[model samples]
Target: MEKRVHRPTAWHVTHWSSDPFSLGAYSALLPGGTPQHRTALGQVLHERLVIAGEACNAGAPAMTHGAWNDGLRAAEAALSAGARKVIVIGAGCAGLAAAQRLRAEGIDCTVLEARGRTGGRTHTVELGGVKADEGAAWLQHFAENPLAAVALQHGLACIETDFSCPLAAASDGDLPDVDAAWIALTKRLDRRLTLAEAINRYMVTLEPAHARATQFAIDANLVLEACLPVERLSVSALDEEGVGYGDRMLPGGYSELVDLLAKRLDIRLNTPVMRIDWSSTGVKVNDEVCDFCICTVPVGVLKALHFTPALPETQQQALAHLGMGKLEKVILQFDGRWWPYSRSGYLRWYDQPASWGEWLDLTDAVGKPTIAGLIAADAIERQFSGRTDEQIAMAATEALQAWAAAIRPTP
Candidate 1:
């Protein structure tokens, strides 16, 4: 990997992993959605074949808590319908949660997981003896989030991170209070216009001279938080949804919740369900028959599975219209803390539009010299997908060094 140190700091990219199918990391409402339409999307089929997952949750889709809540809802429905034996496909957050609830209610159920391990998209990996999350890192709405309640109940280490740190520069004089400007623009954003149009108009109105640095900071914040460019996002949807504030991290890892939910459950690992035969009698998952079934697989994986009598036209249409946001993370380890440490658990760079600019510092939380950088936007994600880990790491290091240099004062 290409290494660049502004002041002789030591660090190395220890390990990294990419999830090609993590398209649903952040779900967006894209410009179209009514109450009736969202309700229809979450409907269960024939009372015996139920669908539950992050994508199936219309209220809060593309979130870990959403998946868990959906699983609980599905389990309740199945039990109320007199379902004694149920088959839950995919032992991810949703599947595990449903099974847990079912077991609590004295209902018989089995969880079939495609992968050998559980947690699904919430994967935690160890780098240089320190555990860090590879997927679904933070609790966006910690105070109000149910997952946070569970973590707190279990005595897991949780640290609150300030995501709204003021914009920084090499000299204090050059730094503008961009946070105030951004909040003002968001407050007055026209709901009718797309996010891209609204952002452009706001920039022209506020920064008539079009300062490149200010624009970069604005775009970087949007991409880092939303995981997609403003052009593809909807102003009304984003405003109404309002990406929850006050994020918190699990120092131990996000998989702790998974382990808690999967306790003593009948889980079959490395078992891929190829087909689901939901006939008039009951649901059959690749020869394993049950009174009811809760399919909580990812949207992409769900689309690939074969059905005996085919999915309903409405479901097919919903899947076709719904799209997943693309995102990837690059984790780096260093011999000791190199970057400036602060309670604000992140570092932002204005080098490139889609560079690995948003980095999460784990030094304070995990007490380790590790940081994970996020790469968002479709174009940059695809570009990184084609290159080697070394190339990506080198680019990230260069961008980080440039940012450090830009913010450091002259000796």
Candidate 2:
């Protein structure tokens, strides 16, 4: 904390307070579950009410692009159901995407957003005259992600980032190597085993040193990538559904993509939907009657909404099974760059048990002295959640200083 260079000149947190739909960042998949659970959560009720968002996407749940794709699917479903006028709720990426697709198809639809802006969780803000994405920053699997196409179409520049971090290289001592065992186990894992169980079983067979290193790598990977601890994650689900290796960042921030999607769309801002009444005849959103309605609100917000006659018991149970994961970032802008700039965009520290160890170096991309410290995992997020902004910033400052000191201790 006494390090002068590590101290941040300015900082900002995108808590998404005004938008209830983005309660956290996005929804998290539970163990032994498929995206089918998410799709089922988006089931159309009575042929009048349709649910759409990243939560409803079976392919890429909890992603901005997934939300956009889900919007298109919902719009198509509404049109196929012979809907004349459709009402889309929550003007985030999902709502805006649905409205844009509906307009393209010559379908009459209106987008009602609770906030006075678009992009939902994808908010871009200026810090020290440089733009940074507060939420939904990366385009994972850019070649396959639909958002990449939109970015390319709009002439937005994207910088590919490699998030791979080797713990062996970072660790001072010679750690045990579990690469062979890990590869062998991953090649043929028991579908019945949870990620934690699988990892524990593998660790028990390894040497004590190797086991410790293996455990650290597994735990860090799960907490850093999935935003969940190993126990809550499914090994089979992860093995079957691999997170693509490639990721890219929008140098101009994600709001640019949102801006592109918002053009020529009927988006009504600051109009929050209080209640919904749906039946075979039609659906009414806040007393506004429409042939069909698409609810793109976040799962947290959706659960709180009042439904006329209430949702089915099965649907209610499905909703209860789904839960949100907490993930926050502490972005610090320094007077000068202290961290080494390299092709590897991420830095991981295993010193603290869930502090802001993983950081994204934005110096190269933003052309500024900024580093965003990612605080993932339930325990870590909860710890930071209870602290004030000043406290969190101080903790981050200490962590960064420690990281720098460890990497290159002063004489």
Candidate 3:
């Protein structure tokens, strides 16, 4: 068994999502907005400029296909304008998708990116000579997800995975005893969904004003995860749609997905958009102007970036009110699966039960011995803040050990 500690060398990323110009990898919405807001945001302004991203699609928001569809929708608006030339912003999945749609319609478009590469947040790195995804890992629920169809249409290969796991919660030493926790969590989730469904049915029978008042109650508890309370999410948030916990993984990585989507498009890289001057004749990037503009940048970036003619106070207020929280995942490698537990993918620990460091065991796709550790925002912040690699590894190992001990009895 060979144990190796992996660390980022020079921040090793080619995805423009992390670039200051882009601000975020993709769009995610918070609470307080209706489906109408999403529609209004995507509308083409006077056949000159339009906005598109995951946020535009109330049904498919926050997924790759959501952005893809949004791009096509925007391109259709541009194509109808009778404009020969158009400017596509951000070469991520959405931007590339828009450009492709416009090109197919025989419309001339130029893609501008802030970073030297495309595929916004979808990037990959060679870890132990195997591709590892740095962004957008899963094609959650491929049955209904449009990305799978798109990937297949583009001749990109995808790996269907059986992501079922032996455990669900945190572990102490090797793997935690998550039966009780799982049961509890499942019960709460089921109840929440049932309640939500009931509310939906009732809303159909109620008057408009009454239905609107009841929606707040239904939205509050649809999701089981406490970190992201479903109540604080948009009322139009999509249901689970039959994708639970884990699903298919892209072995070739998100970068491959991006590469597949970026075919036959004129993408200008390393040209960071400092300001979007939309008040004048058309949108301007780096002082260059164009006929029409399609913005695929994340909402966080839109809120952060300075807009010429200044964004309307209402839009600015919406941007400020609706925002995404921080999420981080830390991948840890092991010499051998010294997990000391007889489980496959997941572990749950509850030493203090603070929800600080919930982790999963990501082994090699071929069932070889390797580990990809995960930690979210609060958990990662609690333990990994300003820590060295060695320190992080030790801390992680110790946490795993405690988790395993909690779940299983000592021999």
Tell me the spans in candidate 1 whose CA falls farther than 4 Å from its real position.
1-24, 31-38, 166-177, 184-190, 193-218, 240-245, 382-385, 409-411
Assess each prediction's global lDDT (C-alpha) against the native.
0.70, 0.74, 0.59
- State candidate 2's TM-score: 0.89
Model 3 lDDT per residue over 1-411, tens place: 443333322122222323465444444445555556666677677677887887677666666777888998888888787767888888977899899988888888999987778887666776655666665666766876667776667676565544454343333233233333333333344333433453445457656543433332222112212223344454344342323343566766778778867889889997766677778676776677887888888776767666777766556555644554334444555446656543445453343323324454445462434444444324445565687655666666666655554564355
Scored against the true structure, residue 117 in model 2 reaches a CA lDDT of 88
Total backbone clashes of model 2? 0
lDDT of 2 at 125: 85
Global Cα lDDT for candidate 1: 0.70
Error of 2 at 29 (Å): 2.0
Of 2 and 3, the candidate ranking higher by TM-score: 2
Query: What is the TM-score of candidate 1?
Result: 0.86
Between candidates 1 and 3, the lDDT winner = 1
Candidate 1 local lDDT, 119-180, one digit each (tens)? 88888877777779888888767777778888889999888777777224422235455566
The top-ranked prediction according to lDDT is 2
The RMSD (Cα, Å) of candidate 3 is 8.0
Model 1 pairs whose backbones collide: none
